[model samples]
Target: MSRPPLPPFTRDTAIQKVRMAEDAWNSRDPARVALAYTEDSRWRNRSEFVVGRAAIVAFLTRKWEKEHDYRLIKDLWAFDGNRIAVRFQYEWHDAAGQWHRSYGNEQWEFDDAGLMRRREASINDVAIRESERRFHWAAPGPRPADVAGLGDTPE
Candidate 1:
């Protein structure tokens, strides 16, 4: 299977890839998200290490189960050859309804087929009041184009 806009990316292709990833993740559908990765993709998300698409599916299933109302946005940081880096922010409420905004960076290495073969992410979550939330788009869907990305605000 081939995922396109493959490799040695131009700036436009890299940005499109980032947006596609953001939209996939916002769907919160583990199976759907797993399609972006290779069958044997390796990932280190926070403190957990996961390998393979089956594991990726299980991990995301558990994540969305606990992180309710999850909304995410990923901004392209850089890209060269087969690698791309992204900075991201996501808002999610816990099962107990406590809100949080997570900040993170991810480095992704994709195969020539344009499927990510490796991903390493470092993330930190800050508890925030529900009123302090920035993402208000409908859940289980893509972020609307009108919503501003991380670049729109002072960093």
Candidate 2:
């Protein structure tokens, strides 16, 4: 199955791919998110390594469970051929109600069908007060158009 805006990416198509990924992740639906990857997708998220869609689904399920009120933004860093790199930030509170913002960079490699086959991410989190949160859209929703992206302001 083809996922289109299929590789050999132009600048515009790459940006569209980034936005589509951002929107899918914002939905916080593990199944929906996993669908963007190849059936045998491999990922390194922080120190954990996960392989295949089933593993991806399990990992995301655990993540969203611990991270309450999650919101994320992803900006295109670069792209070529079937690879795209992204810089991202996300905010969420834990079960104890401690708020944190995570900053990360991800490198993605996609199959010819435009499904990501490998993803590597490095992320760090900083504790913040709830009042300092910048991503205040409704839970499990996309960032609205009026909200500025990471490109607009230095963090």
C-alpha lDDT of all candidate models, in order:
0.96, 0.94
Q: What tens digits encode model 2's per-residue C-alpha lDDT throughout 1-155?
A: 88988998889999999999999999999999999999999999999999999999999999999999999999999999999999999999999999999999999999999999999999999999988888889879888998888998568
- Superposed by TM-score, candidate 2 places the C-alpha of residue 31 at a distance from the truth, in angstroms, of 0.2
Model 1 per-residue lDDT tens digits across residues 50-151: 999999999999999999999999999999999999999999999899999999999999999999999999999999999898899888899998999999
Q: Identify the runs in model 2 with alpha carbons over 4 angstroms from their true place.
A: none
- Model 2: which residue pairs collide? none
Residue 126 in model 2: lDDT? 100
Q: List TM-score per model, in order.
A: 0.98, 0.98
Candidate 1 — which residues are off by over 4 angstroms?
none
Candidate 2 global TM-score: 0.98
Model 2's alpha-carbon lDDT is 0.94
Name the TM-score of candidate 1: 0.98
